[model samples]
Target: MGVGRILLNILVVLAAIAGGFYQLKLKPILVKFGQGRVIDPRGNTDCTTVPELKACEKLVLHQPSGVVYLACSTQESRPHWLPNAQRFNATGASRTDYVASYNPQSGKVTKLKTVNFNSPRGLSLHGMDVVASSSNPSELWVYLVNHREPLSGDPKVVGADSSVEVFKTTLGGSTMEYVRTVEDPLLLTPNDLTGTPDGKAFWVTNDYGVKTGLIRDLDLLGRATTSVVYCHETEGCKYAIQNMHGNNGIAQAPNGTFYVVNAIGGQLTVLEKQADNTLIITDVIESDRSMDNASIDSEGDVWVAGFPKALVLVYEHFANPTKVVSPSTAFRFSINTGPNSFYGQKFKVDRVCDRSSYTLSVACHRIT
Candidate 1:
């Protein structure tokens, strides 16, 4: 071989050897550190344990240590305390509220990751995304509890309107800013969202006193296509709510059963949407007062977020027809602290994370 040709061949061999070494050794080391080393936020090896947390705040298991423990608690109304977890955003402009976090095992949150918003009143989570449903994916599935219908003699805004705005989310999993709102000229405001596993129609709560909730199916463009009701009077539903109006929290089981929980009367009512176009409330659990948000657990138990009360209640799993109407008392809540017992339960907004005033830059925060 020529001198220059031999030199080129030698250079190629060295490059290949270097590349192989990086692929096998250096690359993995870089990845390990890049993922972040699990530094114990608290230095103590002795983990402070609890008999059983009041409301079961959050169960986070670290990978390195193989240690399983509940996520440390925070002051009320704080978001993003636990990094890398996403939550359902509430309405209005303040920022994020109604936050939830995942188990880190299946990447599904047993607890709501904190999110901020201008309005905290209208926010909840099903603990599910429902990406896939029956034959096809669902278009629009929404639920609103304690929903006050316009027919109850409430004044309607003529120029302005009331509707549920939904959108197809962006690449990063964050929802697109602009949403297509389905204007329910008949109803006032919606509270939550619900649908079956197999793609079908969605349900919306209308008049509280009358006990009629609206059900509608949307198209790909976010247009309301099919709209109707799954009610007791119409179909002679087996399990129904009559006296306690105002439905608030909404959830659904894997078996296509609709679970609607109302705040006014504090009741949880379940119904099955029939092929013959009807709704039957198979079970009813009354007196679930102050219940705000709900999520069906991996074991099919329903978890409700009782705000102000700051309580998390869990209803046991159910099979098919014969049902457990309402979970009288399921789970509870408390403020978790460190080894020193420095932190306690945060009952009020001011005790936890709150906004600052002095500077225009929004730099003030007191984690007391």
Candidate 2:
């Protein structure tokens, strides 16, 4: 064979190999882009007319009066990857990190004037009171895994500590009052929390380990080493559930079953709290979408917020918040309370909210 022909053959082989690699590796990511296409909840093609719900997380439903409370953080803040970051380019902008209430009967949302904090993530209501995890930069540290130098001399390096802020409210009232703040080292990266029946204790989920930045992402994507800590009034905090893959939301059912959502693992871990205060995984419900925070209704129904296209939605939301609205779904399921085994089936999924605003939670308040 001629040398020219051999060279042409080798080039063609290399091109074919590159094409195969692109199809095998990069095609899936490309395909995921279309998966995040916003679906009109009103069954229409135009999404501009669709109602926009406030970006919220850690919803807690007060069953007595049918009031659903959620943590809404609508302000543009610094990037988690950047150390000692500040809110830039926002001249007259203000942070809307407060607790909001949804009235099912009137179909109205009322922003409560109670506890105001920066970057409130997880929330839970105990009777007439509520507790939320405030993950401000001062309370929560976002270490740059790639950058070794500390963020020294940065004036915006404030609130790098972590704490759980508590608030008091009425069962069906629209007003609230700031109570106390629980600061602890065990609450590192607290994602979600739920109060006990007596309101004397609570459990918060630490989604990641001490390692931040890229290493924490890899840990969440692989073997999750985080845990759920039980914070008691007199005993401080202790581990209740361990080895969770991005444990985001937690809710205790009326029957004492604990429903924990793993964001990275895309699974709902059903746990049972023993008499000794430890938790045992009873069942696990797998999901195609990445699950966030979850809430349990009085009737034992589970409501969860999930990202249909996790990669695309997350990327688009962080990249261009105005152009690409993150699409999310509210999933509802019922647990089959059997004698020995526990299982659940997803009964419904409502795509009524745009997660581009960063909707991180869902809850249902059933009126008796």
**Residue-level lDDT tens digits of model 2 in 18-69:** 9997787555434433353554443223222213334454456666566566
Residue-by-residue lDDT tens digits, candidate 1, 1-368: 89999999999999999999878855543332222322212212322223222222232222232222222232222231111011112121112222222233343333322223223223221111222324433222212122112232312221112333232221112222322233444333334444333323344543222112222111111222222233222222122222324454455566776666544334456667677644566666543233443445444455553322211111111111022221222222212333434454221111111111110110011111
**Local lDDT at 222 for model 1:** 22
Best by TM-score: 2
- For every model shown, the clashing-pair count is 40, 9
lDDT minimum window of 10 residues, candidate 2 = 139-148
Query: Relative to the unseen true structure, what is the C-alpha lDDT of residue 362 in candidate 2, on a scale of 0 to 100?
Result: 54
Q: TM-score for all predictions?
A: 0.37, 0.67
Model 1 poorest ten-residue lDDT run? 357-366
lDDT of each candidate versus the true structure: 0.32, 0.56
Candidate topping lDDT? 2
